[model samples]
Target: MKVFICERKMEVNYNIAEVYINKILFSHFWFHLLSLGLRMILSCLSSFRTLVNKSNPIASRNQSC
Candidate 1:
């Protein structure tokens, strides 16, 4: 009787722990995805800015004039 009760309790605890761990993993996955997305966007913007600067020498000269 005692062993059966103990086994059931352990199973319940295991289930609760699994839920908590899954929630943590889910949040971490989202955080990683968002950081990667932001990095991609910032890199794209920087590349665009450099391309515009390279192609707009007249704009730079006008500013200097």
Candidate 2:
């Protein structure tokens, strides 16, 4: 009976550790994905802004004012 109780305690501890590790891994994955998305958006926006300025020099000059 004592051995059975000890085994149960170990099983609970193992389960808790598994859940904690999974949570950490998932958060890291999501943070990486979000940063990549933000970088893509910023790059695209900058390129678009440059294109607009190239097509309209007067507008770009006005914006500098």
The C-alpha TM-scores of every prediction are 0.79, 0.68
Task: Please write out the lDDT profile of model 2 over residues 1-65, one tens digit for every residue.
Answer: 99999999999999999999999999999999999999999999999999987879887778998
What lDDT is obtained when candidate 1 is compared to the true structure?
0.97
What is the model-wide C-alpha lDDT for candidate 2? 0.96
Model 2, position 14: C-alpha lDDT score: 99
What is candidate 2's CA lDDT for residue 52? 84
Find the candidate with the highest TM-score and give its number.
Answer: 1
lDDT of 1 by residue, 1-65 (tens): 99999999999999999999999999999999999999999999999999998979978898999
* Backbone clashes counted, model 1: 0
Error of 2 at 40 (Å): 0.7
Output the worst ten-in-a-row residue range by lDDT, candidate 2.
53-62
